[model samples]
Target: MPVQKENVSTAISSDGGSGVSSDRLQAVARGDNIPAEVHKSVFETTPVLKINAFNLWYGTKQVIHNISMPIPRNQITALVGPSGCGKSTLLRSVNRMNDLIQNVHIAGDMQLNGDSIYDSRMDVIDLRKRMGMVFQKPNPFPMSIFENVVYALRIDGEKNRSVLEEVCEISLRGAALWDEVKDCLNDSALKLSGGQQQRLCIARAVAAEPEVLLLDEPCSALDPIATGKIEDLIQELRGQYSVLMVTHNMQQASRTSDYTAFLYLGRLIEYGPTSDIFTNPVLRETESYVTGRFG
Candidate 1:
């Protein structure tokens, strides 16, 4: 395992929670996709998350090797890998969710807006609040839909019915489900269809006001139409939050991510702009997997 870095700021946290203190993220000029200029935007525009030499293990067995990558500010970075490739494990490490599982050990430097997640000074509660996650299955809390969205806010000591209601509306709207569920906020989340339930989970994640959103196969259990809705929601969220998604679906990765990291057998085999990965993969493994030759 790599030695973990001390707490540090990867980017400046400005007014928009962009993590960069600068205001120089000029929109990329006409280009093939993300050019060198766009890569530079990580520093100028403020990357919301940065993971450097991050490694993790369960008990004494290592899962993720030394993996280092930058998640661009306000863009989606999809982690695509075959089964047992550590994509989900890597995602959990970002938010330290693995810490909750027994015998699970971590050796990594996961930085959210410049602070190492393992740093002793790092507050897990606050860290999780800033880096919310949506799981593979839509596990809505057994409560009213409104309550699910308000759970975190309430945990953070937010009271006042009017304030909660307003924030709930905003979050649901942001998840693109307010129009569908506006009339039934008080209904049980379990009553909704699979797609609506998934969107409700998204709303709950968003309600926490996280800067980085980690999704683990968020559409794996949904129908095509529902998947499209989630994809659209992810697109609409690009500018407001940095998204890191784990997906086995190659086409979905190509369609939704700005950058893609291809992992195999616990190693990050390729990491680059999505267009390049799809059109011209550099590694034999990446090309084979993305081209449907073999996972």
Candidate 2:
């Protein structure tokens, strides 16, 4: 059902903040087909990835509705929403990771640097090569740190030791982990602390020199200190790599992302600059969700 003007006006007058009624939020949670309120500023920046009318289904169940947005180049974009809202599903779709799930299907298209992502003629491996992905938890290969960082190059048949060493050092420096592990490059990656392991995983991803980095709750499994470190690294990555991240921490999203997209019940609710979405949203639903009044 479409949002009624009376309901919105009444809610705005009744509540000084958020200005969203419980009935309206409930309607959204019920899978109602409310149109997404995308702000104009979202298109002001050059997009490295564009999602156009994207939809996804797991077997017969639809999870992602007709969502569309542009991820700005060399900026961090955060996808924020309650659990089970298809944030991670949409992130994985960028690299075609969703194809691994049985009975999963998607319609619409995502373009990376103007190339169609869902096109049948596209090379899945090549597509993945252009993007780097980090998961919820730190997943470092059991091999030595050096081996772990250079795994992608090895897979591509890189045999020169000097080239591997140079790339490993550069990637580790980029991930801000070189000074700590420089002497122990041969140590097992599993032996590192939780935060170090996560940074190592980031270094591994960076070694590929991907066009975009996909982070799925990269700091969710760590302690506050580790999370802070990861957040710092994410900030350092801005202007160097286009980052599309799914995060549940509101403060983290506001602190790290340039653009923020809020989703509910598999539908996009609002998307725009982080400052506007958090401080002066175009819709009360967005304000309510961001201010913790409702979700």
Best by lDDT: 2
Tens-digit lDDT string for candidate 1 (11-122): 4344544342111111111111221112233345456788777777788887776777778888899998779889998898888888899898766687888888899998
TM-scores vs. true structure, each candidate: 0.83, 0.93
Error of 2 at 51 (Å): 0.4
Candidate 2 Cα errors over 4 Å, as ranges? 1-20
Q: Count steric clashes of candidate 2.
A: 0
Candidate 2 residues 1-295, lDDT tens each?
4332223532544445444555655777787777887778888899999999999999999999999999999999999998999999999999999999999999899999999999999999999999999999999998999999999999999999999999999999999999999999999999999999999999999899999999999999999999999999999999999999999999999999999999988899889889888887777667777888655
Give the 10-residue window scoring lowest on summed lDDT in candidate 2.
1-10
lDDT of all predictions: 0.79, 0.91
Scored against the true structure, residue 179 in model 1 reaches a CA lDDT of 96
- Following a full C-alpha superposition, what root-mean-square deviation does model 2 have from the true structure? 3.8
**Where does the lowest 10-residue lDDT sum fall in candidate 1?**
23-32
